[model samples]
Target chain A: MLQVIRNSLYFGGVAALSDVSFSVERGEIFALIGPNGAGKTSMLNCISGLYHLSAGRIVFDGKDITRLPAYKRAELGIARAFQNIELFKHMTVLENLMLGRHVRMKSGVLAGGIYWGKAQKEEVEHRYAVEEIIDFLEIEHVRNMPVGTLAYGLQKRVEVGRALALEPKLLLLDEPMAGMNSEEKEDMARFILDIHEERETTIVLIEHDMGVVMELSQHVAVLDFGMLIGFGTPEEIQANPKVIQAYLGEESLLEVQG
Target chain B: MTAVQSPFAIGCGDFRVNYTQDMAIYKNVRVRRRVIFLVILFFLFPILAPEYYVSLATMAGIASIGAIGLNILTGFTGQISLGVGAFLGVGGYASALLTTRLGIPFWFALPLSGIFTAGIGALFGIPSLRLKGLYLAMATLAAQVIIYFLFNHWDALTGGTGGLVVQRPSLAGFSLDSEMSYYYLMLVILILTALFTLNLFRSRVGRALVAVRDRDLAAEVMGIDLFKYKIIAFAVSSFFIGVSGSLMGHYTLVITPENYGTQISIEYLAMILIGGLGSVMGSIYGAAFITLLPVVLRELMTAVREVFPNLESIFIGIKEIIFGGIIIIFLIYESEGLAKMWRNLKDYIKLWPFSY
Candidate 1:
């Protein structure tokens, strides 16, 4: 469904993603894992059209969307959740998801102004779609609640729910399990797996948690100092020399502290 | 935390329920009936009330319509505009000029002037697509000053600082030259405007405006065109304010440049602030309160001055002091505004029998 072709580009006299490339198959859970400043998020941003590729092309679903705007990409069934959960805080959860259904909505400003006829019919249909996602996410009780009042973990889930409301062909989850407890991590992993297996949604996730990635992702891409060090299955990723070397220092430190 | 309940609680208890219930213009059956009753009252009051009271009510009705427009922009869209008077001025001048010079019928001039002013407001709001908050407010403020300047200096178009005399609007050969007829017409327009605005909240454009207001970046990511919605907000608001302006112009039989200036914009803001920001009924409550304040104060001032000679200036000073004080007190105590306070009081009475 997607691929990233990297090149030796200078980021303020430093190389960010150095001539690296990888392809993700449709309906697969692709995990991007790396240390801090590894440019994992940068690569995701390029894929999502938040930032333009400096030296390569981004072809998605047999179309070149390299120069498209973020919203345009979203219109083409590309949905992304931010690393720091970006929900419309003052708006109700329903309203937030309703906004997610923005691309699919067929009504124009003129139709909305009349508030009867076609607009009302379209609104009722959209409401049904949003309610289905709410039921799927098990957020029925807090459906009308403002996302701001929810706990951090629930907020992250709501963000995913919003992206799901888009019913995208490709979903980009940026650090969905960041700053979560073990219980929350399990919940998030289960949800991500459900998105991949049940909905047949192509998912590209940036995750720092090794266990979650190994358990949930079928393919893994490792980044180190803005370079693609490894790309393969979780088993292959664990056995990769560069991957082992990357985690060795942290592992030894924990051992020494113990 | 005391876990205090708001006196203004009307819908379901929590924010979630409150939000869902508020999505409806008339939340419950009772509210719907009340709205219908008010619509009837709007058309009836002019015929039923005395001439002076009818005039006052008409002015309130007109101002309320304008305030509702301002509320949509400032309260819902989170774009602070200090140029309601300027937009109104555009409408007033457009209607006055069209009716007097072009010989267009009053009925045609009213809506045409509104559309004309909306165009002008959209022009001013273009910078709004890129600017926000204090910057946007300043841009609108600059627009207000520029409009006022043009109104004063453009003698050819606006008849100079001497102002333009407006011919009363007539519909279907029936003259609205009298106060009663003007009042009735204004009342009908006001009710229609309010109803239109009420329905707007449930629509996509309205929802988009709210989304942009809450989190613009998120909305942009969600595929909402921020520039389009923001400008639409200004345009719709201008249309409503313009209609109020056109009505006022015809009713007064005079279109003075000074009448539509920064002071009136401030007065509208004060009404919204004192009444409640973002609440629909707040606009009406606030507009009525502010419109009637000077009159109420004048009565008190006259009585006080007569009882104690040489106290007129002091009473006037006290008016300004109290005016500022009220705004401050409301901001500090009930930041949600008087409408919230009103709602809370009603809720407290409704729930009084139950123990905490």
Candidate 2:
């Protein structure tokens, strides 16, 4: 469960997000839909503690996480996949996933190098968790390959798998299906559904693909010029006049239906 | 998952059963045997080699320790430091002062010096949180100048330009006085440092350092403390460098500011760059190559002079140019360094008769 109350974010005198408010319930896939520069990413950045809010606060799992650092928020079970796939390019897919288990691991330099008992055990446990993610995403083939060498669709899957590797209570996915082919998009939609159903993960996804968003999200929030224009179920959001005018426009609604 | 038969194959090898085996230092029995053989050969080298070559090997070993330390910071962590020479001086001076003034034994002084250098390195690393790349390099360069000035001018503490005389360490009345004895001491330490460094990446911290090197923003979101890891990298790197400095000071029985100047720091940087960034064994190769180049060049020049006695003066000027040219060529053609080249060679050998 997460709550953002009237969050405002500014960059160099320009308001990236203004008075935007939304709440995501546990075990729900919430979609934030908007056109370009609609503050979807700004809101996600604010929630993840990457950007400081100028006004209001964020509450996650009953704690005020407004001022927590990014890593601290990560420790509190927040994980995110970037819009552009921010993976460690030089590292293998397995290494990138293992990094997601970083906070859970407790080996210092000495124990890590020596790796005799406790460190060795921890590494094995984490590797098992990472391998499960690799299998779940069907990226076992590229598991040992550097992330940079993977195709764009595979890299996006790897990024999502990396977030899943954290076993987070809340996962933020920013454009996870962007630049993906139709088959890749279908696979990603299925993976998102599986994560929501089987893992019971609360997710807040920012997406431009209206079809995927409407199909997968239990709730939808539409943004326009840094303001939340509509918040409802998929059917209600489809009929909302303001959302149509600001985001979907008149023609795209028929496209969504067709 | 299907097993494929090789063209020139032995029996199917034992596969890794667990994470321990998977993350082992040696991947197979052959590698383990080769490593053991190499270690034995290193230990027995001084017995077969002459005194001059033994001394050169000892110098290479000492340089290897420093190069490995530099590689951990610059190569692994992606933090550029132009202050290795000053850190080495800090170690040498700290050890020398401890042994001479407080009358501490060499063993105690050695570790103490490492700690002292680590502290200084951490202090220098503080600005790295806000700085990166060339700016961070300039900041570390400032550290080199400041520490060098202190070592040069602080007469009471560092003995000024006159330098300090250090005694060779002895254990239980057994002096490490001879070059061979000292070579053994340095060799043992080098092996331990190599093993420790090689195993470092198998741990969480080591992975964190590499992650930071690859992408700091992503590493941060993954819950790695970027600043904490950076400082730790600097401190750990300086620790090994300090130990090497102490060893060198004791071996030579002298500590001078000139020995730990900016040129020496550059040379160490060259070692890691030529050896391969982020490689443990690459550091050894780099140290050996850089250490022996001048000697090899001088020998070549002498041989050339004997052939054409009038060409000596031009050879002297051309030596520096050749050194710079070789480094440039390596950077242009083999930017991954000698380690990657060596790996490519091994792969070629393994896949012989089939160019695939």
Candidate 3:
């Protein structure tokens, strides 16, 4: 459950997002679709607490999380998979996933330094959880390899697995299937579906592929410039003239009118 | 990521059976045995060696502690500091003052000095949240200059460059005044510090710090509080550095600002750089190597002076050049430091006859 009310973002007097309002029910894959610079990523960044909005409030799981720090939002089960694959490059995939378990872990420096009793147990427990994610993503083969050395598709999968490692309530995925092949994209789509169905995790996804967006997302919101131009069920959104006009050329819409 | 295996081999000998085994610090039976053997050898070294060698080892041990501390900040957390010298001074001065003024026992004074220096180090580290790379390095350089100035000019507190004389500590009526006794003490402390550091990198806190170093933005989104961990790194690093300073002060029975100059800070940086930036054992190796270098160079200079009477001054200049050149060479070719070299050597031996 997440709601954004009249969110506005400005950068040096230029609006990145303006009055973009939308809400997602507790267990749905909501898609944010737009052309280049439609502020989909910016909106996700604001929700994840990376970027601060100039004039708006974001209410997540019934709490106003507009002012909470990024880490605090993560603690509240909002995890994100970056479009550009921002996994810790030098660390092994297992270590990167363990880093996702960082907030949940409570071992202090002393206990960690000792590493004989509770800290060891804590680590093993988190390792088991991380292993589950690795299994889910089928990354067991390269689990010990540094994330930076992995192929692009594996890195994207690890990004998703990292977000899943947080056991997040609301996961934000930005261009998860971008630059992926058709087979890889299909695998990612299936993984996203399984994550939604099996875990009941709410997802806010930003994607470029229109067919995948229509097939996977229950609700779709189209943005053009900084404004939310359309919001409805996937079928309704596909039929909406505004959504087509925003995505296709303005000349196409004008030619139709003529 | 799998290593090439020999065709004649039946199976890989170092297979871990479980997650616990996989993540175990000692790794395998052989490694555990080697660690025990090394521990025994270190314990026996000072007993067999002469007093001069013992003293060198003691100094190297103390330097190892300080280098490991600096590595935690610069190498692990990716926060470069030029203020290690000042932080060490804070510890030395803090312990010196505590023991002389308050009449505290040496044991209590050591930890107190660490905490005091940690406070100062954390204060310096606040700038790191907003600054990075060379900019953060400059801020810490300011800390070095400012703290050294206080140590130099502060008349009543720091003795105004005259330096303070410290007393050797004893444990349960047994005096640590002798070089051998002090060497044993230094060795024990060094082992503890190494153990703590090694154990640290195997745990959650260590991974978080490394994550911060590699990708702070991603680390932050992963729910790691970047500033909190950075400050913690500063405090923890300074704590050990302070302890090392306290040990050094007591060993020599002197506390002087001259010992903790900016040049000394650069030397500490050199220790970690030459050892291995992020490896704990590399810090120890670098410290020992750097510590013995001047002694070896001096021995060489004296040997050459006997043959060529007028060449002593040039040798002094050459020693400096040699030291600078070694660091430059490490930066160019062996930047991973001795730790990686050690690893490569071990892997070579293990994979011999078909090492690939």
Candidate 4:
């Protein structure tokens, strides 16, 4: 459903990502694993159109989305939950989720201001959809609370809920389980599984937690120093010498065999 | 959507069943009735009050329109604008030029002037995509200076320092020439502006504006076009300010460069600050307070001067100091502004006798 063909991104004098290529089949949870500064987020940013690619192309659902704006990417069934929670802090969780459905809303300024006719109906419909996300994420308690006031784990859930509110065909979760407790990580893994299975959403997740990554992802791509060193199933990636070397120190190669 | 019953309810319980009921302007029938009563009282005030107070009401109403406009840009959209005075001038001049030069009717010129100001405001808003907060404010400040300069120097069009004369509007052959008639006109427009602004928050564009304000980057990633919304904010805000300016010009029968200088822009900013940011009702409260402050201060100063003739000159200077001082106090003690204070007071009253 999504293909990143030899995508490269540069920032100033440095190449954040270099010739990284990957493809995810539809309705699969794809994991991008890497150590600190391994270009996982950069790859997601490129695919989401937050950063312009220095080279190559991205095809999503058969369209070349290489030059599309971030919002255009969002409109084309792509949604992202940032590595750091990018939810609107001053807004309620519900408001943040409602804003996630912005591309679907059709009300212009004048019609929105009047808000008694078509605009009102659209708002209600979107609100209902947002409520389902709130329920699905079990964030009904914090639905009316401003996102800033929520705990980090709950805030991450809210961020995921916001992306889900898009009813996205492809959801990009950057470090969804980062900074989360074991219980929160488990819950997030479960939710990601549910989203993949029930909602049939194609998810590209960037996670540092190797355990969660191994358990949840159908396919795994490992990056080290802006290079995709391994791309395979969890079992294959675990046994790959390059993946093991990139993660464990070079001296720990014997430890991997042990 | 079952209505939950409150145990020992002190205030009215919200029994909203559907989205419409939940999002209703008033929470309940009682609140709606109370609002209607308040509106009725507002319309009746000019009839019962003295002519001077009626004139003050008209000015307050006009200021409210401009304040709401400023609030939409600065308060809701998080775009700090110091060019409100310029936008108002653009409207006033546009209306004046349209009526005087083009021989258009007052009714026609008024809306056209709003459109003209909106165009200018949108033009000024382009830099906001790259700039934020104080930088954007400085850009708008530049707009104020440029527009003000045009009003002063554009002799062939704006009549320069001599100013331009405006005729009161005649609607359906009934002239709105009297102060009472003009007050009614301003009051009606103020209500419509309030309603439109209030309803705006319930819909997509309003949420988008607030989202842009809260986090523009997040809004962008959520598929909200930041530039489009920001320009829309500027255009909508300037439209209201323009309409108010046109109304003011017609009411005063004159449009001058001095009327829409930087000081007036600061005053409009003060109105939203003191009233409340991101609140339609707060804009009205702030406008009324700021608009009436000078008159009230003058009265107070005159009364004090009568008692202490030696300190008469100091009282004249004290008004400006007190104005600055009050805003400072509000900023320090009640940064949420009068709307939050008013909400607290209402909550206090609701929980009266218990005093919690």
Candidate 5:
């Protein structure tokens, strides 16, 4: 489990995230949901080491990882899929997945230079890992296909598969179902649940889809204007007046009852 | 338990084979046999071919070495370098100086020159930390200009504008002064360098380079040091080019500043662009085509002049037009270069009887 403390992030002397705190439990699905500019992404960026904390610290599995670089965070069993789908366009799906196993690979330049003994063995082993992930994602057919040529939904799945190949303990899905259709969104939500249950990976998802978030996440945190308005179980978040006001306008709530 | 019958299964899971076996480079018995056959043919060609063809092959081999290196840095890394000739010149002039001026043997001078030039390349690459795209390319162009001036102005060290004559490398009391000897020498080294470079792509460093090329931010997020790897790519690329330069110097038995001009860099760029970027095989095909084009043109010109005496005046104009046309055609039609065309042709032939 990682503890994300009450953190404030300053952007150009303006508060991007002010006094926000949340903890992602071990092997559980956590959701951050709010309206536009709720600073949900800023909070994710802080945890991922993309943004420096102006105050407070992030302790991952009992180790303070606040100052670590983004890559260092990835190395420490944290992997993220971008909201915009940051797949390597020119590379094949297999090659993109193989890159995920790069951190797990131990061979240095000397072994690679000669391509003898252990390096070859290790490379073969890593290739198997990639193949397994490809199969798991049901993307075996498109293994050789360049990611740029794949559909947007498939590309997003491929990106998730790539991050999964890293074998991270904590997986961050930034708007994993943002632009997906109903069927695609259902498939993605199922995949996310499968990953959490099968791999025992703690997942933190940022999503605008309230129905999917309410259905999937065990813990939910609602933010409004870079501030945490509500944090608790899905049931608690659904019933909170503040959460309702953040989603539906205060005037609209009274009009609904009338 | 019943066996899995899916045609798309990873592989035939026999006792001795797996998915790795199915995707192997030397897959199956037939491929291994073909590879051995090809190796024999490659080794035997130089011995059987004529002296002029051997000379042309040698030029292709040397140029291929430089092209492969440039392909790695510019093509794979997406750095758009314009100072390949500068690096080549550094290697050639340094080796020439070490041998002719310092009284060192050519054998020692060759490798040392490569390292020396690589160091100079790293210095030039330092500017990359600040500049990018056209600005970065212009910075490298500036480096080429500076080196050209140094080669011209450094009178005592570089023999001024007169240039320096290089004594041929000797191995085990055998002087490699003859064209045949030089061809075989370059062929051996060229093969080794090419194979080394191919193996490089299979390594973690190579993957990191590709990652950086695709997305530097993502690469950094994956624990790869962007600046460190970029420099390493530059150093390795420069080293290969430098080695090729040493071979070029030994092959020609002369080192000149003019050989390392901006035009030469453009030719190197054109070779990779026309051949295919980031492809080792493309480098070979490109180098061979570019190197032999002039010779073929001269021969055609000679034949035309013999047949039609009036065509002599128009030769220069025709050559320029054809040269420009070829480049434009390749750019427009074959953006993936000859390698992709060759692959399609190969697939067509492989399934010829079936006619897919």
Candidate 6:
């Protein structure tokens, strides 16, 4: 359950997002689809609290989170995976995921220094949870490996696995399958389906793949030049002329549906 | 996670059978035994060696503490601080003032001095929230000048350029008047410092610090508050530096404004760089190497002077020259520092003559 109302963002004189609003129901996968530079990633960034909306309000599960800091938003069960793969590059996948559970861990510098007591117990508990995520993402073998040297698709999966480690109420994924091959895409789609079906997480996804978007998402919102042009179910979005015109340039989305 | 070799692996690996085993700091009994052996060897060295060498060991041990503190901030957290020398001075002065002026015991004064320096370090670290890289360096450089100015001009507190004097600390009612006893105290503290920091980097706090270093944005998304952690890093780092400074002052029975200048900060930086950034063991090796360089060169000069009297003047300043040259060579040859070299040595020995 998340709501965005009258969302607008600007950089100098240019509008990155303008008067865009949308709402997602609980336990549903929501899709934000648009052509290049159509503000989908910016919208995700805004809702995730990485970028503050210039004039808007974001309500997450009945809490006004528009002005909440990014870290605070994370504490409030919001997690995000970046399009550019913003994982901690030099740290191991295990450590990266452990960082996802940071808001939950209470150990401080002194406790961490003398780490055989409370800090060790907390670390082991979190490590077990992280290992479960590693199992879910099928990356158990690479748990100790630094993500910097990981392959692109694997790195992308680690990104999602990190977000999942938060046990988040709302998860934002930006272009998760952008550089993935068809088989990797299929695998990622399966993982997303499993997460939705099993965990019942509310996901907001930014994607360029028409088939994946239409098949996986229950609701789709199309943006064109910073404005919301269409908001409906998958079948309804495929038939909308404005979405057909602005998203995938008329023939491409129509061809996917056909 | 990739095609490259995982650096976290122990030699030949495959030992872990469970999650608890996997999370262990010492991967095997052999590694644990080896560490104990090395620590025992350190304790035995003073008994076997001369008092001169023992004094040198004390200095190296103190330097090790300061260098480790710098590594936590610069190496692990990726926050460059040019204010280490000033922070060390803060500790020395704070402890000296605490013990002499307030008549507090040495045990309590040491940690109190650390807290004092941490306060100052956090104050200087405030600019780091908005600055990075060279800009942050400049801000810390300003801290160096400002703290140094206080040390020189704050006559009532710091005694200005005349500095302060301290008595050797007594532990559990045992006065550490002898060089050997003091060396033992320094040794024990150094071991604790090493163990504490080694424990630190293996846990969640260390992970958060490294996350902030690698990508602050991603860390923020993961709920690691950047400002809070950065300030914590500053405070934690300075705490150790302050303790080190206090130890140095007590050992020498004197604390002066001249002791901690910009050159001292540069040397500490060199310690982390040469030892290996982000490594507790590397800090020790680097500090020992840097500390012993001048003394070793001086001894060699005396021995060579006996054989060839004409060669004496040519090597007059060779200690400084060799110090700069070794750091440069280390930078080019092994940027990861001596810790990496030590790891390579272990790997090589494990593989043996096969050389894979």
Off by over 4 Å in 3: A254-258, B1-11
Model 6 clash pairs? Answer: none
What DockQ, between 0 and 1, does each candidate earn? 0.47, 0.77, 0.84, 0.82, 0.51, 0.74
Candidate 3 residue-wise lDDT at B321:
87
Which ten-residue region of model 1 chain B has the weakest summed lDDT?
Answer: B13-22
User: A1-258 in candidate 2: lDDT tens per residue?
Assistant: 899999998898998899988899999999999889989998999988889999999999999999998889999999999998799898899888998899888889988767678888898889999998898999999988999999999999999998898899999999998988899899999999999888989999998888898989999998888988999999999888788777647787677666
Comparing 4 and 5 on lDDT, the stronger one: 4
Point out the higher-scoring one by DockQ: 3 or 5.
3
Judge candidate 1 against the unseen true structure and give its global Cα lDDT, from 0 to 1: 0.84
DockQ of 4: 0.82
Each model's lDDT comes to: 0.84, 0.91, 0.92, 0.90, 0.85, 0.91
Tens digit per residue, CA lDDT, model 1, A29-131? 9999999998887887787776766788788998988788777888889898999888988778888888889889877656776667687777778888888
True contacts kept of each: 0.51, 0.82, 0.85, 0.84, 0.48, 0.85
lDDT of 4 at A98: 87
lDDT of 3 by residue, B1-356 (tens): 99998987645578887789989878888789899999999889988998899899999999999999999989898999999999999999999999999999999999999999999999999999999999999999999999999999997999988989899999999988898889888888888888888888878999999999998988888898999999999999999999999999998888889999999999999999999998899999999999999999888778888788878788787887899999999999989999989998998987887976
For candidate 5, write residues A12-98 as lDDT tens digits: 888989988889899899999989888988888888888999999899999999998887898899988888877778878887888
Location of the lowest summed lDDT over 10 successive residues in candidate 2 chain B? B7-16
- TM-score of every candidate relative to the true structure: 0.90, 0.96, 0.96, 0.96, 0.91, 0.95
Give one digit per residue, the lDDT tens place, for model 2 in B1-356: 98887976866667888866776889788889999999999999999999999999999999899899999999999999999999989989999999999999998999899989989999999999999999999999999999999999999999999999999999899998988999999999899889888778867899899999998887888788889999999999999999989988998889999999998888899899899999999999999999999999888878888788867788788877887887898899999799999999999987886968
Residue pair clashes in candidate 1? A6-A19, A6-A20, A7-A19, A144-B16, B7-B344, B8-B343, B8-B344
User: What local lDDT does model 6 show for residue B224?
Assistant: 88
Q: List the residue pairs that clash in candidate 4.
A: none
The interface root mean square deviation of candidate 2 comes to: 1.1
The list of candidate 4 runs beyond 4 A from truth reads: B1-12
Candidate 3's TM-score = 0.96
